[model samples]
Target: MTALAVGCPYPPCTVPTRDLQPIRHSELRMDTHHRGRVLTLRRIAPVVKLTARSWTVTQESSSGGTERLEVILHRSNHGQDILESESMFMVKEPYYTLSDQGDPTLRIDHPSDLVVCTGSLGNDISCPSSGEPGGAVAATAFAAPVTNTAKECKDEGNAALKQRALPRALAKYTNGLQLVAKDTAANGSIACDLHRNRAYVNLLLNRLDEAKADGTASLTGIKDQEHQDLDAKAYFRTGHAAYNLGDFQEAKSLFEEQQRLAPSDRDAIAYLRKTEVRLHEQATGEYDFRKIRAGLSKTAPRADAASFDRNTEVKKSPGRGHGLFATRDMDVGEIVLCEKAFCVVWGHEDEALTVMTYDVRDDMIRGFPAGLCKAIVQKVLNNPSQIEKVMDLYGDYQGIGKHLIMRDSGPVIDTFKVHDIVARNAFGPGPVYSGGPRAEEDVRNASTGLWIRASYLNHSCVSNSKKEYVGDLMVLRAARPIGAGEEITHSYNESGDYDARTAALKTTWGFACTCALCLAEKADGTALRTKRRALELEADAWAEVEHAAKAKRISIVKARCLARSINDTYEDVRYNGLPRTALLRIRKWLTEATTRDLAGC
Candidate 1:
């Protein structure tokens, strides 16, 4: 039999001297000295038993020593190498062995204990009979070391805390503290951050005490300017809580602290001021909230009017109910309801005429009635209470200088009632003195008076009411049977086309018009376009004939036909680029012809 060479690849004292033994079918066992420790082989198994050809061993010791060994084993058949053996072992220090049924098991007797081993060897040696061909043994084994119990608890607690389980996080933090017996930086930092976030959430839910407690917790282990800033923010939140609870004084104090901390912060300053004002009002007993309620009650319009019978029903549009309806059958001249003007502003020019300091020498110009104007002006000046509110609401008049006739630092003019009514009712042809060619010759005047209920009428191209001024009062007569709920409308501008009317409505009233006249006019655009084109052609023909007449070249009969065409085309040519003077001359001629034509009959 060939003598088997059994030697450890590890250093001197690490060699194995034991019989071959198997811990399992494919596993081998070994123990050796590594570094200064007598380390034991726990177990070894070949990943592929038939394929392995060479073996390697590595060892580590308790005293921080390491050893590496490689051994080549071979099998031969008829002087030829059939299979080269392979093995590998990882050995820890303080090696030891156990035996069961002639199979030796290798392991570390004490994993954490200290041990010593030999460092150097001089030569290789043959294996002893008691030693295994592929195994190892160590001199002795040491005892196992102890571990801290609290670390496990801390780890479990931390895992729960990371999942945002607040209760679990607190428990973990407590467990970690119990193990370490003092605050740790990692655990303390996490706890502080978590508490701060929790405090904010609690504040949102209006749990004031809870929020304050959490905020206090957040301050633990936090220091310096950041802590003070956070404290200021917390005080601001506390102020908000106090404010919501109607504790103005407390709120003010907190907000004042916030302002001191952040002087430039607008929100803090505003809250502080507001709370101070409220507290001052409370202290002085100056906040008469009941007076405000009474004033609002007095200003509210009466819902029940005596004029309309409650039992009567008026027809209205399909979806909309009746707004205002006639309670009784009324004559044409009957008054509806008298209402004072809600507000009024004198025309810029009229105000200028009244406040003038200069003397008027021109007889053709009419001066304002000084007595009435003065009384109105004095009323405006003397009524400080009225003027104060008005000035505050609308701001000061920048155009006052432009309209001033006299600079009395006294009261403003108050003659709004008559003038305002007149303005509402006044409607006529275009302004005669527009700054065009005929501006010097044209004289424009607005009808002045105490305009009746007709003044409140709305506008429409197709109107049911006819308005006429009698001395100083405006008279309105229904031209058709106006239904009870129908609005009393008037034509403000007779010359306005559909688009012009719609535009005026939108500008003045802030709504798109759905009036019958607007609907009809919009429907007529296609037909109106054709008619306008024909009118343009007729106007052009008339212009040529008028040119001939101006040169005194056209015959009398031809001139008459052309004059007729001019009258028919008046609407089409009125707004054209014709010089105002020339247009007026042509208008005068047309008037004369029409007058003659009427006289001949």
Candidate 2:
């Protein structure tokens, strides 16, 4: 077996005397010891089994410090080494095993835990030269040793936190936690304080699960009246974690407990309101969209809205990877789903925040839509438990179904993988924009977000549903009655000639739309295309005249006649029940004109 030592050195006595040896099928053993503090194992080896017995030190160091083992698995690809998985184990219980398991690659208990890969790696892949992997590493697992007393470590942690050195503070808090003995009432109270403080740090670090665990742990084994403040904070932190984790009921319960403890706490009061709003949204798909939209900010682009709907489900589509299908019959104009974006970049306020990368090979400009990849990466980094929201969506990345590995520093994430997902799945600034040739252009220039469930609804020219956006919230409504088990689809583009629509879909989504409307247009051949071209020209000429007519500078009667003439062109069975771009424009203008005329009423 081969091993590479990494991380800072510890006192000789703190180092385990025995070596971590490879375990066979039924036997575990310890081998020769290395003087270094950290060990690295390559999966290329037949069986790399690391057990904790050989890694823990028996004698307490002079500083009363301890060391925990963190295992980080990485895979090298495209000259970049990205994290595959990470895990932390206490020194006394560090047993972990990795095997080829018939596939001759990698196999673990939790296959879905691995980060999505951009593509298959070549045989020449190599690890990075640095000892530590970069990006959002957890600080608690390898904290420096501190004095044995819990109070001293807690004080040090508090001081570090005040200085805004989060990672250092986490180390101190973790060290204090290790020294705490929770057997007695006084000691347990001290333990509670340490747990609550540590939970706050974890909450800041975006380690939601750890924060909740610590917060809940702090609430137990103590009932001191003097510690009410600490208990209140613990409840608040746990509630925040649960809320972000989409557990509204638990969050509400936790927040209510905090309120009971700290009646006048304004923060607790604020969270209770947000929790109630989410609860209401979950129960009923109604929302005050205008209020939500007006609430967007640089720090808070999306509200803590509930993404709730039970009418649809995800299932594999024959050609598409997956698609959303109606689980129950839906009536026209009924809400299909109302989903909050996984991440959104608001462009209306910050028009300069866009990132565009031109693909030389593909001969197309791929819009990153305001560097949303960074937002996604930061979101996953903060609350890694929600990574499934980003990873399970469609992307060019082929690496999936791998187990997740966590390191002490944090979960290893590949920005490129996230970038690929964002580029492929992000939707525009808003669903409603100006119509005509400029509509696609308007969508391209607006804000964009990744809505996981909504992405599964495939595209159709004459779609069964229509989607609208309110801030980052996406509301899908049935445009026509849909039957149970019917696949939900919506048009991805504005109304245009068949050639323009097909070309746009092919260039943007890489799929030639084969919807019934397109098939009918295709079967009509050249004569139909010629007639449509003539109508398009006539409409363009009439549009100029209609604008003058609306301004009262031309005869409105001529404009009305021209509009009726265009509407009659689509009266054929071929265009029946399908979107008529020409008629839609005319109807929109007439409706607006009638509304203006009725203002006095």
Q: Which candidate should be chosen as best, given lDDT against the real structure?
A: 2
Model 2 lDDT per residue over 67-166, tens place: 2222222222111222222122112112233221221111111111222211112111112212233211221222322334688878988998999767
**Highest TM-score model number:** 2
Q: What is the C-alpha local distance difference test score of candidate 1?
A: 0.36
User: In model 1, where is the ten-residue run with the lowest total lDDT?
Assistant: 118-127
TM-score of each: 0.24, 0.66
Cα lDDT, all candidates: 0.36, 0.59
The TM-score measured for candidate 1 stands at 0.24
Model 2 residue 577 distance off true place after TM-score fit, in angstroms: 2.8
What's the C-alpha lDDT at position 64 in model 2?
Answer: 26
